[model samples]
Target chain A: MYLLLDQPTISQSSGNVVDGINLEDIKEFAKAFKLRRLGLGLTQTQVGQALSVTEGPAYSQSAICSALASQMLAAQLSSQQQNIFEKLDITPKSAQKIKPVLERWMKEAEERYASGQNHLTDFIGMEPSKKRKRRTSFTPQALELLNAHFERNTHPSGTEITGLAHQLGYEREVIRIWFCNKRQALKNTVRMMSKGMV
Target chain B: MYLLLDQPTISQSSGNVVDGINLEDIKEFAKAFKLRRLGLGLTQTQVGQALSVTEGPAYSQSAICSALASQMLAAQLSSQQQNIFEKLDITPKSAQKIKPVLERWMKEAEERYASGQNHLTDFIGMEPSKKRKRRTSFTPQALELLNAHFERNTHPSGTEITGLAHQLGYEREVIRIWFCNKRQALKNTVRMMSKGMV
Candidate 1:
């Protein structure tokens, strides 16, 4: 079931609230997410760049990872080819053993959402990396291309990048870079827009 | 062009830099956005909520608005929905216009971006007012009906709520409430998703 958090004055301790979050947990979650967004070079404003600018109404700095977020927005802004399963939300004890399970998990999530279970809640006790190291150089052009591609693909029938590349008069490799950078860029942008990743 | 903010740390400047942000005019620009988002009852995280969680990344708390200083986050996130007519790095008066100019600015920005300009040099400005209060109330049946209609409408030629409500034996008022509530629910969901809000 989806949650409603309209009341801003969230009680720190009600004693009876189920699955309720506490101030201490809030602080811990906040710190980790903050470090990740910044360490990953994402700012909250940038994360919502695609959503507010491209898809829907604007949101605040928080609300990045809650499964109860916008379904349409998620579908609209996601990196089509970038599997959500690969996101570092859940950890696997062994990559080999968990590969199939991971794939199934993706399928299930997609189906569940499609079947109208908009809010997802299982994370399998996954852990994010303490320090992630992604070393790559990307340009703005690359980001634009990928963003365009993801947006287009979210539609029923996808478009061809070859024609797009030809129109833009750039190399295919450049276009590929654009998609790669675009996904990362979107991720950073999404995170920033969601939680306030400083 | 788009900018790739490098992970490389820039040495803090004792002589000119205002805590990594050059304040001269940016401060006023920041203030304008602060007033805008807050006036709208938006926290920083709420401003960035539309982007990624609109898609479906997991939730994070701290990292959501972590990368942006409150001022900058407020400025950029507040203006994410609107377009900018000036450079973000310019005088606050120039940057402060980002909020009001957003919608028109976004179209222009898209055009300019398509033509060759990948980066927006300025953050947009806006005028926010608590007077522009959003409607967030909905009856449960209305919400259920609207969501049901949404599911149907997702198909190629999905049904509209009016038609669905008729089929579901509900009145037009009920359907309208459902739609209103659904919209708010979606927006609220996005709000929560940003920085993994409530």
Candidate 2:
């Protein structure tokens, strides 16, 4: 049931609907969001930073990329228009998901402004109390085990990742990300070496 | 001259050429590669693993995705056919770059086989001497400084990354990747938290 719920659906229809959400509605919201944000005198970077300090899900560029790619594929949007549309930085699915979050934030900001709290920081909510999780520190032993596993198989299956996470007493997601970063490191090394050879 | 050489050109011609490399040539090579690997009784996984051990650029999935996405966009391939064609896992640009490397490896493997070296390990060359660089270890103080900077700004410019690397005595590339991984971690945390809320 969980798997069914999580399954990704490829929308083939031309109506621009994905996951039962209207893409047209999302496009409208994206335009309105930009205008509203600008009216509040906030930059996208400022909003992103502020959201990190609040209880909202912080916007990451890759998240936007994934959502946009999937949405663009579904919507059958022209490749030429991709650059212009990217300014919105919110795809149909992500726009639908984040609509309420941004709406609430905008409402709060407006209320604060009306109440004479006009400072940029006052509405952006740079509260230090709501901090993100601290960076995970791997013990030397754990690192050894991880490196050994990586040497054996750079791409581990989900089961292998979960098993290793259990063995090392870390979150499975952390283990998965460790492999991801390790792969990126390996790629970078290969690229640098290739350049040196050139 | 270097900047001009490195600039990415968006192929506007309908001749299926990108960066002066023909897409049709890449498609042909991709098809032949699958057949050649099968003739050697090797799976794609085995080939990927073997390539990593050789003095060749390791094939990271993201590298393939980026190359493939760009190629597909240029080729204007139907989105429906993406999954079917993804098996090749090599774009025109990447195929052009890596073709010689793969061809060399294949030639050596065939030579060894003809000389009666049937062992998979012998041909794969799983030598420990050609190991990838050791994992980078960040000191506790470095971590503190990185975290402090991250709190101030999650996305740093190239100049900022170079400066930070110099200050910490790490490679600029390593610092760049640290920020990338940190952003991934933040995204994963936000995703997990959103799920928990639901």
Candidate 3:
């Protein structure tokens, strides 16, 4: 995520700001937020669950996911058009709005962690959401078929994903998410390897 | 990293390619490479080690790391300037060079896996490298302190990282890598949550 943060050259050259908020500041805080969260031994799920309890339905895991994920995603964009898309994109806007919320929540979390882990847990105050989608399980054969398709084309059209869902007897949305997640997982594995190399 | 792949709207508008390689094609191959590697039950470390043997001294885990990591990283960039930077950057160039190597290795591994896991092991063909870096370990207190600092600032610049090393009695490089791994770990955790949310 800080890949965008380290871009002093770009930011300095462009001098772009959104709603009087420096993108650089948001980028910096985001990096700090992740570091702070890990230091307290909290996963994003935990933080999301905790925030939901205090911030109401507005701060669910999906909210956290969309917010944080967008920043990380935005950092990876390398083309002018993609950069423009990011500026106008709802995802990055959502991230911008969510930044202050995350910043405050992290500060509170760090303060609690400073006091003690027990206090930190109390601060987290997990209240499980009543509704959670059941875990999707794909058969080995299904995975094999999916992998074959993925090998051939990583980005399948909506119709293609729907076709896959029909063939696999799973929901179309599930198939869509499977591809999204599969891509994210591959990126992460490479990232870990990169860090190891460094 | 197909997050960037699924973006037809953005890609069509920008239409960027590097080194005569369609970004889309590279993205697809990376996803396929990962899925194939997993299906063969080989970890990135195993693949890295295996490649080290065949690619000689020039192709260590770090080489594999830079190559594969850059493609995934390249897929994520949304800005044209950043895209140009990525192409010029050694990281992506290294990644471009290594892509074909990985593709070949994975093909052979898959053939071996189809035969048997036993045969797959033969394909891995481990040869111990004499120049492996010793792993770093941190004291609980050191971790606590480091976390404390990380909470305050994620990007501590070179001097701050150096200062941390002096205070912790570790090499500056080790401290830097720790932060890098820590950041990667946090991103992975959120990505997992995002997938679950979907």
Candidate 4:
């Protein structure tokens, strides 16, 4: 169980982060800490001990989940630690990386909770019934074969693609989707270049 | 093999990133992308396709490696990206997640080399040679069991250690080191907090 520490507000002051950090950045990290722990498959109690909170009770799953969703949608609801940034008004500059930032913040929050912090809550903005899309995971060997084939032919054709799939003993569609995702990822990276999106 | 986009000066004279991005961040991402690809088990050409770079004539294994190492380390070396207010000029704060970050960087560098980027040839002034450590990656469940056990009785004496190990079906030393690393992680996190080490 996660220990929710009652945070005392510092200043909600804004300043450029020293060493690439600021309160905004820290807030962003708080979101991430929670998310990463969740992603790491740790329950709140496990997270609490990992962080070392000896005083408080372990976090209930709902409380942890709510804190993640709520904080992402809005800031800390209560006055305790209200010094967090202007709640959840994610700026235009943030890209998809915004979600990862929130996840990181959750990781930090988990860390805080472990230190005997009081119960903090967050609500997921999405419907409880909603399900996230499962991302495609690639295997190292499969990727190598594809890379090798690509290096052999600067611009491969559909036949070539199918042939390689046959050679690799896989269906053509998987190769097709891989190409599609790769293309999209590149586009995003290049776009970041154009927009100077960090 | 990886495609070598014509060598883009990470930035022209003004040093503003080609996009609004800090060059280091993109470079960092490029490395991460390479790692993700490597983790996927893909070769340079495969990664090229994913990024939508044409494979074959322009792409080469060596180039891929160059991009991987250069992009990852450039940020670390960049005074601009390092930190705006690092009074002590120590490691970057982003450097906080050292193990995972460095591991990811290494994986990417391998991919870049396979793709034929020659940029790593002159990376002389960067980080110190890494000291190798032997630590096995633990399954999440195992880590949980260890963390939970520690919470109840932190410094278990000999029989307690053996008993806990016997109960959990773990080696006494594994439990021992889990506590060690757990303590270390907490100390570092707290140290980061006190030093404004975000």
Order of candidates by lDDT, top first?
3, 2, 4, 1
Q: Candidate 2, after superposition: displacement of residue A154 in Å?
A: 37
Cα-based lDDT at residue A179, candidate 3: 79
User: What does DockQ give for each predicted structure?
Assistant: 0.04, 0.03, 0.03, 0.02
Q: Which ten contiguous residues of candidate 3 chain A have the minimum total lDDT?
A: A1-10
The digit string of per-residue lDDT tens for model 1 on A51-73 reads: 22222322211123221233212
Candidate 2 Cα deviation (angstroms), residue A186:
28
**TM-score per model over all chains:** 0.23, 0.31, 0.31, 0.22
The DockQ value obtained for model 3 is 0.03
TM-score of the second chain for every model: 0.24, 0.43, 0.51, 0.29
Off by over 4 Å in 3: A1-198, B1-14, B81-88, B91-93, B117-119, B130-198
| Candidate with better TM-score, 2 vs 4 | 2
| Candidate 2 overall lDDT versus native | 0.54
Candidate maximizing TM-score: 3
Residue A112 lDDT in candidate 4? 55
- Candidate 1 - CAPRI tier? incorrect
Put down candidate 4 lDDT per residue, A62-101, tens digits, no spaces: 4444433433322222223332222222321232233343
| Regions more than 4 Å wrong, model 2 | A1-104, A108-198, B1-130, B194-198
Candidate 3 lDDT by residue in tens digits, A1-198: 323223442345243354444455556656767776777777787887776676664344555655565455444333332433333332334445655566567767776667765667568776434457899899877887775565334456678999999999999999999877765565564665445331
Over the stretch B1-198, how does candidate 2's per-residue lDDT look in tens digits?
112122333334446554567565544444455566677766554565577666555655444333333332323433333331243332334446655665677767666666765556666744433556778998877777776566446666678899999999999999999988876665554334234321
* Candidate 3 residue lDDT tens string, B1-198: 222223342334245466654564555556666666655545555666677677764565433543455565565566564653423233345456666677667667766666654545545635563444435457687888886665455556999998887666555777999877655544543443333321
- State the weakest 10-residue window (summed lDDT) of model 2 chain A: A1-10
Q: Evaluated with lDDT, which candidate comes out highest?
A: 3
B54: Cα error in model 1, Å: 37
TM-score of 2: 0.31
Q: Considering lDDT, which of the candidate structures 1 and 4 is the better prediction for this target?
A: 4
